[model samples]
Target: MYERKQEILTKILRAGRRTYFFDVKATKADDYYLTITESKKFTNEDGSFHFKKHKIYLYKEDFNAFKSILEEMTSFIFDKKGEEIISDHNTEQKFINN
Candidate 1:
């Protein structure tokens, strides 16, 4: 018998060569948690591409602290950077669209 985790919801965000996956999954007891995965694409010298992924498993107990810190960090960045597009990829896209 094969056992697999059930996913309640899935959301994906693609940014340049990186993709982020937010998956809400249920445990054996039907308790829900979240998994956040960051997948980045890299090209090898042999003309091949590969993906490197990092994942975080977040449970209900840590949700509040996690959200609070995330919001705080993002707010700090915005306060310092003032909504400027600093990445090369974003700059190129902005010029292309304009």
Candidate 2:
């Protein structure tokens, strides 16, 4: 039934210019685990390309440690690499509404 499929939960823990996806899915024994995915969209010279994804699986027992490490790693990267600004100078939010 559709309800059975809906039982699995997925959430995005963090979203930046580089997006990360955290998804919870089932095992053969029906146990739950996490899948972490990094997705980056790119454009080719021809102007058409797809997102590149790198994924890793983490089990329930490791969730706490994994979350702590993930937070530390991203913090280190942010400290090392400066932040980026993305803006559309011509289009304002009110203008879009108008």
* Clash count list over all predictions: 0, 0
Candidate lDDT (C-alpha), each: 0.85, 0.68
At residue 96, what lDDT does model 1 achieve? 19
Q: Estimate each model's TM-score.
A: 0.88, 0.58
In angstroms, give how far residue 45 of model 1 lies from its true place: 1.0
Runs of candidate 2 exceeding 4 Å displacement: 1-7, 13-17, 71-98
Q: List the residue pairs that clash in candidate 2.
A: none
lDDT value, candidate 1, whole model: 0.85
Candidate 1 C-alpha lDDT tens digits along 11-89: 8777777777889999988999999898889999999999999999999999999999999999999999987877645
Stretches of candidate 1 above 4 Å error?
Answer: 91-98
TM-score of 1: 0.88
Alpha-carbon error at 13 in model 2, in Å? 6.2
